[model samples]
Target: MDLIKTDQYGRQIGYVQGANIDFEVGADEADSINDFEIELKRWNWDGSIRYGTRVFSPDTEYGGIVREISTDTSTNVIRAKGDTWRGMMTKKIIQPLSGQDYATASGELNSIIKSKIEAEYPGLFYGVTADTGVTVNNYQFDRYCTLHAGLVKMLKSVGYRLDIRYQEGDVGMAGYVKVSAVPINDLSSEYELTNDNNMNFITDDNRRGINHLICLGKGDLKDRLVIHLYADQNGTISQTQQYFKGAEEIAAIYDSSGSERDDLIKNGIKELESKKSSMSYNMTMTKLEGNIDLGDIVGGKDYLTGISMKKPIGRKIWTISSGKEKVVYKLEGET
Candidate 1:
């Protein structure tokens, strides 16, 4: 793998060669901020690489902005580490204007994101696009948080993921950031890994997961709005269960500022989704047949445990050293 250095604006600076590099890409839900590090001998440095420099891997087509650089005078080695473009969003906080408790938006996901960015930071070079066709009737960011956190929260509720990439500049143009809301791919039917295959994996069966939530909404005591949220057989959150083997109930107090029952239910559902039992699988494979990427669901089975599951690929890490690369895949959720 070759590392290419670029200016903060994405203009090509030069190639970063003869360095040991470790690059990682993460799904929106699991680890949204991808990161990388490079280590090389000080004598081999050309001094072109500095703070704010962007490093990209052509093989992975993933890049990150340099955030820190350090040196070891004793060993004459320099190391640089930074977060990917998605991390840039963390630098900006989403806050409502005067007299408003929440920063709100409606309409298509992409349009809402674009509007927010343009409204908050005019003339910003970032671009937004979406093809997931998801729209929210009412979305609110109540507390001040990083733009990345706000966007991830909004998209996760609608079954989408944030995608960030750097688009190379065209003629007479400087490269810029491109953001998108994309549907999480369900590729379980196409790819399945098992103990019999050329893959090594570990299964985590967390029995302490919450399966039911009793949500309490606005109003006073007996008059307060109430609702029950459950993770059904399919792991889908709903008000009632058609088939129930056992119940693990917990009380969840909804935001007092939210008066609508719909809002309560929505918040409860999101909470239940996260609290469910985790039967997760973490697998490492040297090669895969299909084009499997982050945010895509893949099938896994452990014959010893007789467990078969399909979960989203949450994170991927690539280590390039000694002219060899190794990749690790992490799947989120359980059977």
Candidate 2:
């Protein structure tokens, strides 16, 4: 396990101890913001106040870069906290023409966003261009929002699911990002947890059908109930009509593009399906244990529930001067 520390200019100044280097995979909030943290011994750098100088680190993982580095000086350690490349998507605000080809506009904006970050912190990431197949239809809007949120909107405009992954590397790779995308129903489940592996805060809330997905339409499409049109026709479900106070329509930039209305309906259906079964657990794995990729499906049997499937959800890593560093994988899944 190796963690190469870099200076503000992405220079290899020093290497931190693998034993003192503590990190984990995270999905801390509802947005599933996948992040990783590095808590290491304070290092010597120039032009920066005690851990104040901006620094980026390309750890021994799969070319993943930690965009920011701070310190946990309380313990005489330099703690660097960072999120996945997706974090770049939120740092900027987006405002595209409603009539612009949704696909072209998004591609352009994504390129623009990456341009700013890549100029500073260059990593071994796979997509420095518009290789990701995410697209949105031309939608007129008189607003501004986080480009990350907008990317989610564009992703839903098409039928794709975001699949996020994080792993504390193998034999020598420490940890790296294996997957972060605008789509991932392609997730696989794993049965890697057992009593030998410590686990805490495990719970499951299974409701046969308790999802109410509502999409508000703007203008003439206001108060339109498209639930039945998109929701499951399974006889074991119930629904209601509701008003969408802030719904707006977006036409596709291309003649062969998907209908805006159809996009919204499909988006709603995805939400409902995700609510089918909910499970939560806090599984603690030794730093040397198996790999954990955020947003991937993990299947296992608990001391109580016997067997179940879980989605790796949240993470919190603890760094100690005692040399006992550990990683926690917060898993949530729909059965």
RMSD of each: 5.7, 10.9
lDDT per residue (tens digit) for residues 86-157 in model 2:
554455566555775332343433443354334433442222354565443353322565555554444445
What are the Cα lDDT values of the candidates? 0.71, 0.42
| Model 1, runs deviating above 4 Å | 7-9, 28-33, 58-61, 117-125, 128-132, 171-173, 205-278, 285-291, 333-335
Residue 100 shift from truth in candidate 2, angstroms: 8.6
Best by TM-score: 1
Residue-wise C-alpha lDDT for candidate 1, range 181-205, written one tens digit per residue: 7777687777778879877888788
What lDDT is reached at residue 292 by model 2?
Answer: 40
Model 2 regions lying over 4 Å from their true place: 17-89, 98-126, 129-145, 149-189, 206-282, 285-292, 313-321, 332-335
Clashes of 2: 11
Question: Which TM-score value belongs to model 1?
Answer: 0.74
Steric clashes per prediction: 0, 11
